[model samples]
Structure formats: C-alpha cells, structure tokens
Target: MRERYEFEGKRFLVLGLAKSGYAAADLLHSLGADVVVNDSSPETGSKEVTALREKGITVICGGHPENILDKGFDTIVKNPGIPYHNPVLKQAVQKGIPIWTEVELSYLISEAPIIAITGSNGKTTTTTLLYHILNIGGKQPLIAGNIGTVACTVAQNAKPDEVIVMEVSSFQLAGTESFRPKIAVWTNLYDAHLDYHGTSEEYALAKAKVTDNQTEEDFFIYNADQHEMLPYIERSAAMKIPFSLQGKKAEGISADDEMIYWQGEPFVKRSIIKLLGQHNLENILAATASAILMDCDKETIENVLSSFTGVRHRMQFVKELKGRTFYNDSKATNTLATKSALSSFQSPVVLIAGGLDRGHSFEELRPYMGRVKAVLALGETAERLVDFAATCGVPLAVKVRSMEEAVQEAYGVSVEGDQILLSPACASWDQYPNFEERGDAFIEAVIKL
Candidate 1:
C-alpha cells in the first residue's frame, strides 16, 4: 500500500507456512517478487497452500529439502517459531542470505508508524492497553503481530494516518534485521525461551532488537525496575523513557499505591484503574507513557484504564457461580506470571495449574502460595506441581488428568467466596496447542459447572 519497490524482482524464500508465512508469501508475490514457500508441516493441500500455488508461487510442503536453497534466493522471510539451528536456516547463514521474520516485512511496507511492545511477559496486555488508549483518544490504531493477527497482513492495508500497535515476541525479534518501531516498549525481562535461545543473554538480546534499528527520532520506553535492561537502554539511540512500580523517583512514568505519576507529576489515581495485579500496574504505566507520547489526553487514558478488565486468557474473569468467582489466566505460562496472578487476590484460591514441565522448579511459586487454599494440577507437570503445592503446605493438593477434571476438582475444593483460578505456570503445549485453547477449555468447563 505504501508503494514499496525494494522487494520487486527480488527472489525470496518464504519458510514455514502458517499465518505469518502465508501472509509473507502472498505479500512478496504481490510485490512482483519471485516467491517460493516451504513448510515442514504436511499441510500441502491446505487452503493457504492451494491459494499460493494458484497464484503461481511455488509451495513446497512435508519437509525441508536438502537442496532447497540451490535456487539462490535474495532473502528468506522465515516464520518466527522455526529455530536458527534448523538445517535450512543454518545453510542460509553459511551462504550469507538475509533472513527476516514477517515483522521485518511489515516494518518495510507499512505507511503507518509502528509502536512495538516486547518482553518476557505482559506484551499482550500492554499492546492491547495501548491500542485501547489510542483508540479512545481518537487515534486510528491497528493491533497486530504476536497477539494473533499477522502484522504484514495488517500493514498491507494500513493508512499513513493510522498507528500500528504490535506485540512482538523474542522469536520474531530474533529474526528481524531492519524492523524498527517509532515507539518501542520493553515491558520487563525474565529468563524465558532458553531452549530456543540456548541462554538467557541471547533471549534478552533478541528482545532488545525492538530498539536495534531505532534512531534518536524514535522513543524507547522500558522497565526501569529491570536493572539488566539498563545497559541496553544506555546503548539505544532512541530517546529513553522508563516506567516503574517504584514510585515517582523513576522520573518517567511511576506508580504508587495512591496514584500513577507522569514524569513526577500526578496523572491518574490508582483507584480508577480496573486491571488486576501489580504486574498489570507495570503494564499500565508503560501503556500510559506511550499514550502520553502519542499525545493521547489524560481523560481518555483514565477512561480506558478504569474500564479495561484485561485481555482474554490473561487474568480474564469468567463467571461467579454460588459466590465462587472463576478467572481464566491460561497465559501465565511461567512462575513469575502465576506469582503476579496469585498476588492480585486476597481471597483463598483454588488454583488450577500445571502444564508442559519445561524442567523448571515451581519453587519460585512457594513464597506466593500463602493464599492458595487448594491446587488442582493437570498436564505433564501435574504430579510435580501437586508435590510442590504439598511442600508449600497448601491444604488441598491433587493431580487431575484434564481441564474438565481440574475444573470439577477445583469447584469441589472451593467454598463460598473462594476464587477458582486457571493460571497454569507452565506451557499448555503438553495437552493443548496453545494457551488460548487451554483457556477456552477452562472457560467451557466453568460454564458447564
């Protein structure tokens, strides 16, 4: 839509055909580039694959061919989930072919200035919040990236007057080269995706790429509480803005128990904010800072914050039956997130947790388990989490086989005024495809009850 001619006539390889891959291949082909799409998944006859082939783009499926790179492509638009250690990607590296995620493509073609949010957690909440704030403030904003909608697909129709609020993941950032956002936010850093990155440092660096191509004209809003992020902040050429839960002294955007401050000035009172958890306060501060930079009015920000409960699968309230409230937080795929969810409630909790093991100890959750009345664990890490719950001295700890079982058991253990929460501190990959499906299962089970 922005009349990008750089991709024209260039030979491109679009790897791993999911949503991002399909969008990338389609965009590249439309731009008059010679595009070949490859996917390891055996969805060869799928609608997307069929469509691409009909458009005269080569669509290869089932597995990566050893000689696939023989065609001498100018660039590879790779799907984020595919690791660099992948044989075809490793070969691309050896041959010095440029590899990019679809975000890079999105950045190149979009007429709209992008506001990107990335971190180990809170990306979805922060992205959604900022989008809401900007929308309510009369700014035309589009939501895209890792939050679900393909960014390139959004970019194709993005108007120059619009703004793109993107949720970027470490995997997507890792494959980026020239993908700079006009406003970049690093919510907070934690050890995550170690298997994909091989080390915490690599993961952090990948997250840092949101600011990599930025210049002094851009804005980098980061978590001041994360000392590990300081070095990266100092190195960025973008104008630095910080947000913290640690009061007004943070000097950018800070929050106390009473109020949210903007550069040491009172902006909004804490009581008016509706989102749950201290971690969400961090998200609020970050989103508020970005909105202020975008010239969104304080009243608009306050209105959005006061009413925005949360994004789905992330501390979303379901239903209250017989005075026992249910919340679906299947997005809490790590201990830190679960800790935040646990801290949000004062009532005794019947927590339904556990999923893919990921070989990490749930010991980090022990200190926050004081309010957990019972633990209904499920999936690959069910037994281990229940054992850990026992060690935490939780009164009722049981391993359940499925979400339905977990929901039933949680209700059985809960009493009047108790909170039944589905905040799995592990990934849903063991039993569900993703956190969303896991959350949907929990919600359906709760509805059934």
Candidate 2:
C-alpha cells in the first residue's frame, strides 16, 4: 500500500463525496488528519458515503452547512464536477482557504512520474494508447483521470513504481491549481464548454492550464499542426517536445505512410492501424510520440499500437446495413471532431448530424457538402444545420426529428461502399441524456436496419 502522508493534525474537508472524495477522505484519515466528507446529494453518493463512514470517516450528505468553511479546515479537496462558480469554492476563495481538486492532491502525493494528456477530442484514446505502450515497453503505468478512476484515488492506491497516465478533460483542467505532471501532452484544442467558461478564450486557457503549472524541468508535448495551440505554445515554460503530421519533422516525432520517425531516428513500425481517419492517425502519432518521450523503445511502441484497436463511442464500426457501413461516432460532440470523422471516408457519406448548438459557426463545414452525398440532420441543431448546408448548395440535405428516422433515410439513400456516419457536430443534451446515449441509439437503429 502507498504511504499516506502525516497531515500532523491538519483539518481536511472533502466536498462532493463521490468515489474520488471517498478515497481522498480515507487517505487523509490514514494520515491522522481530521477529515470531513460532504456530498450534496445523498442518493447520488449514498452507497459511497456509507462505505466511507463504515471505515470511520465522517460523512455528511444531503447538504453542506453554510458555515462549514468557517471551521478553518487547512485544505478542501473538491471533486472535478464542482465548477469554479460553486458557492463552496467561492467561499473558500474569499476565506483564503487552500482548496485543491483531486488532481492537485495527486500531484502532491505522487512519487512516480506522470504523463498528463488533454485535448478537445482524442485525449481519452491517446491516454489509453500511451498506457498500453508504456507497459509493453517495461514501464508500469497506472491509467486513471477523466476516463475512469479519479487521480487522487489512483494515487492513494498506486504502487510507487508505476508511471501515471491521465486522460484529463477541460473541466478537470479548470478546477486544478497546482496539478503539474512530468509530461504534459496536449493532443489539440478547440472551442468547447463555452456555456460554462462563457468564451472560447476561457476554455482554451483552462485547457492550456494542463501545462500552465509545468516548470522548466518538465516537458510539454504538443501538436504543432494545431494552429490554435501554436499561437499559445511559446507561453509554456517546459521544454517542448513537438509532434506534427504535416510540415517538417521536428525534435519529437512525425509519421508518413511507411514510418513513424523522430527527427533523425527512423522506425518502420508495423502499423496495421485499424482506426480510420487522418485524425485517428494523428492520435496514433501523438500517442506514439508520447511513448518515445517516456523512454519506451520503438519496437514496443510499434507493437502495442499495431495490436490496439479504437475505443467505444468514438468511431466504432457498428455493422453493414443495406450495403452501407454504419459507424457510431457519438463521441464527436463538436464540429472539429465531426469534421474529422466526415473527412475520414472518401465514399459518399450520409452524415447523421446536429445536436445542441454550442454557438459554433457551421460555415467551414460547407466545403464538406460535396464529399457528403446527403446530409440527414437531426437533434435540436438540425434546422440550423439544414439551413447552413442549403447555403452550401447541397440539394440532398434533409432534416429529421430523431436518430431513428435519420438512420433509416440515410440507409435508404446510401449505395454500395458508401458510409453512414453519426458524427454530431454539436452537444448531445438537446435530445438524449448525453452523447453516449445518442451514439447507442444510432447503433441500435442501424443494427435493426
């Protein structure tokens, strides 16, 4: 077991007693710290609270006392879901209380090196790939962060010998203060979560914070091709390990068809990469580059990548329905990701798009109208997308009420070798509970067809 630090009678309060919070509470208690666990929803976090309380941890569910912070807790570790605008966090700031997210807390207790990854889309896939590559290369890696397990929880359970591979999201990035990783891999960035952050600039800044805390000793890994990240790349204090799929080969790595190569080092990786699209290849390049930076040998990196397949809800090839391949890419929740998915195929695509509008411009997607045979729009953003595609001179553009109607129509129109892709370029909250639900529905409907 990992050694819990001796808090020396310091008071530690854990807000949002979810899985991460329970782990935080236990670790704090083991260190002889006075720990208080608070969860606003007992029903949501009920079982977790009971388990923690069974271990002698103080857990208060249902509501947080207004004067709780007045007790002078030395630190408050907040769950990532709690926004920056939360009253608890606001009060903590006002009272000058040291508040940390689980990620921030992980950075404190972590002895092993951390490889942190963040981006608008491919971070989850990249993180999982890197974890596999590192382990195959003889480095034990603990996979955690936004993809599954929480960071501090992983840290408390982690053996000191492993490398921590974290799939960090922009929301998690926003709440962290000093969560510095040894290797910060920024896959890419784009306008997302404008609803919470209020602006694209704020969202970018929050995503950039994954590297904001890095020191001169740390290394910053970035995609040089992303124009969004290029303008802000110079701001990083860490030594840059840049990777690019386009342009000149840099100090890090680059990949052409035959090889995944560094500046001068060449490795003809046996890559029968199953994942489609240039974006996925870029994801592979980024993950492979990260592996090399972490001291993974070229052979191990290549081997792990060759054997690996894509993740669920991203771009899983569902099945062939009426001669058309149905691809469930319900994870493409924004225009950039959807654009990548759409551009992946040279075939005539019947694109099932539209979802909640995040105030992004659909003007750039007009160029893709020719490649897409028909645009079957659905979700709340359907009408707006239909209007935009019409302006682009697409005669086959049509709007439908739901995913089922859209899928059936798309299947009807698609010929042999054509593809039906569910890559919604907008948020999923408009119709479904989330993107996963939307993607699942797409798969279910297509399978029946």
Candidate 3:
C-alpha cells in the first residue's frame, strides 16, 4: 500500500459526491481526517453517504447549507466539474479557504511517478495510448483520472514501481496547486471550456498548471506546432521535448507523415497507424514520445500504434446502413475537434451537429463545410447552425429537435459513398448529460436502422 499523507486532524470539505469527491472523502476519513461530504442531491441514504456516516464523517445532502463557508474547513476538495459560481464555493473563496481538486490530494499520497496528459483535445486518446505502450514495454502501468476513474482512488492502491498515466482536463488542472507530473504531455491547445474559464488565456493557463510544479528532473512533451503554447513552454522548469507532424527536431522524438524518428532513426512507420486524421497523428506522436521517454522499445510503440483503434465517441464508426457509413463523434463538443473529425474523410458527409450554445460562432468551421453534403442540426444551437451552414454554401440544412430526428433527416439525404457524421460542434448539455450519452444514443439509433 502507498504511504498515507498526514490528515489526522485536518478538516476537509468535499464539495460534491461525484467519483472524485467520494474517493477523496473516503481516503481522508480513513486517514483520520474530519471529513465533511456534501452534495446537492437528496441521496442521503445512498451507499457512499451511509458509509461515510458510519465512519463518523459528515454527509450533507438534499441541498447545500447556507452556512457551509462557516464550517471551518482547512481545505475544500471540490469536484472539478463544479463551477466557481456555486454559492458555497464563492463563499469559501471569500473566506480564504484553500480549494483543491482531487488531483492534488492524489499527488500527496501517490508513490508512483505520474505521466499526466492535458490539453483542449486528445488528452484521453494520448493517455490511453501511452498506458498501452508502457504496459507492452513491461512497465507496470495503471490508468485513471478524467476517463471515469478518480485520481485519489488509484493513488491509494498505486505501487512504487507503477506508472500512473492520467488524462487530465483543464477543469481538473485549474484546481491543482502542487500537483506535478514526472512526465507531462500537453498535446495541443485550443479555445475550449470558455464558459468555465471565461477566456482563452485563462483556459490555457489552467492547462499550463500541469507543469507549474514540475522541475528540471521532469519531462515536458508538447506540440512544437502550437505557437501559442510557446509562452507556457518557456515558463516550464522541466526539460522541454517537442513532438510535431511538421518534423521539428527533438533529440529523441520527431515525426513527418512517413515515420516517427527517435534519436534520428525511424521508430514507427506511419503506414501502419490505425487511427486516421492529422489530430490523431499528433496524438500518436505525443504518445510515442512519452512512451520512448519512459524507455519503451520501438516494437511496443509500433505495435500499439498499429493496433489501437481509437477512443470511443471521438470519430467512432457506428454501422453502415444502406451503403451509408455513420460516425459518432459526439466528443467533438467544440468547433476545433469537430473540424478535425470532418477533415478525416474525403467523402461528402451528411453532418449531424449542434448542441448547447457556448456563445461561440460556427464561423471557423465554415471552411470544412465544403466537405459536408448536408447539415442536420439539433440542440440549443440547431437553428443558428442552419444559418451558418447555409452561409458556408451548404444547400441542405435542417433544424431538428433531437438526435434521432437529426439521424433520420441525414439518412434521407445520404446515399452510397456519403458518410453520416455526428460530430456536434457544441456540447451535449442541452439534450444529454454528456458526450458519451449522446454518442450512445446516436449508435443505438443507427443500430435500429
């Protein structure tokens, strides 16, 4: 078992009963901390809540208490998804109570070195690929964080010889203070999560925090092509390593369309790569760099690259119905990601898009609209996207009320050799809880057809 950090008498307020919060609350309570777990839901009799109560930990549900700020907490471990606009969090800020994400708490207790991957996109794909490569290379590897598993939950069980590969998000990175990775892979940056961070600069700053506490002993693998990330790269104390599809030279890692070079030698041939698209190429390059840095052999890296299918809901193929191919890219909740998905194929696409409006225009996606045969828009921004699609020279644009309607409309217009893509250039919040749920619905609908 990993050694526990001292929390014997510290008071902690876990401000959500999500996976991270539940794990953190449990860990802190086990270490003899005065833990208070709170959630807005009225699941007072829930298993986790009841267990915490049995251990003498406080469980507050039904609603957030008005006096939560006065509870005298030494620190507030918030679930990353919770916004700063929450009344309790705002009050805690006013009271000067320290706020932390479970990532920070995990760092305090983890004995294993961490390879943390963060960016506006490709974090999950790169993290999973690195984990696979490391495992194949004979390194004891465990994957967690942001891909459904909580950080602290994995930390408690981590062995010293293990490598914890984590998919970190901007939300999770923003709340971390002293959480540093031994190897940090920042895939690429883009304008995303503006609703939470409020600005592109703030969003980038949050991602840069993954390397904030890293030292010279650490490695920072980043996109050499992301000129905007140069400022953050200059600020990092870690040894800088660059990965690029443009063939920028790094001592151990560099790549072109043909092959990836390690120490000036061809490591992995690009011809065998299973995942298509330039964005996925970037992900593979970053993952290959991190794997090599961890001493993974060329064979392992090449094997994983050749066999790795792709991450779910991100350009995932559904089924071919009546000579039309359907792709579920519901994870493309932003214009940049959706654009990447659109660029993957040469065939004209019957595009199903739109969702919760994040106050951003779809103007940037206009260029990719040339490849779209028709647009079946849905969600809060459905009507607005139709106008944008029309302006982009798309002849057919329909505003539908739901995903099923969008799919049905797209199928009517699609023909042999035309692809149907559900790459919403907006979030799923207006219709579904998350991209996964939205993607599942699209898959189910396609299967029925």
Q: Which candidate achieves the best lDDT against the true structure? A: 1
lDDT by residue for model 3 over 378-405, one digit each (tens)? 8899889989998899989989887777
lDDT of each candidate versus the true structure: 0.93, 0.81, 0.88
Comparing candidate 1 with candidate 2, which one achieves the higher TM-score? 1
TM-score of each: 0.98, 0.90, 0.94
Q: Pick the winner on lDDT between candidates 2 and 3.
A: 3
Q: What is the C-alpha lDDT profile of model 2 across 1-449, one tens digit per residue? A: 44545575899889997677877788778778898888888556467777777878788778878988887898888887777687878898898887777787677777777889998879988888888888888888999888878787777666767889988887777767878888998988776677777888888888888888888999888888887787667888998988777634747777776666787467645356767877887778778877777788877876777777677788888887557788988988878888888778887888889988767788667667778878898877888888887887776888898888998899888898898888888879989888889988988898778
**lDDT (10s digit) by residue, model 1, range 1-449:** 78888889999999999899999999999999999999998974599988998999999999999999999999999999999999999999999999999999999899999999999899999999999999999899999999999999999999999999999999999988889899999999999988899998899899999999999999999999989888778889999998988777647899888998988998899999889999999999999999999999988998998899999999999999999999999999999999999999998999999999888888888888999999998988989998899889999898888899989988987899999999999999999999999999999999999
TM-score of 2: 0.90
Candidate 1: residue 119 Cα off by (Å): 0.4
Which segments of candidate 1 are over 4 A away from where they belong? Answer: none
- True lDDT of residue 105, candidate 1: 92
TM-score-sorted candidate list, best first: 1, 3, 2
The candidate with the higher lDDT, 1 or 3, is 1
Q: Which regions of candidate 3 are displaced past 4 Å?
A: 248-252
Query: At residue 378, what lDDT does model 3 achieve?
Result: 89
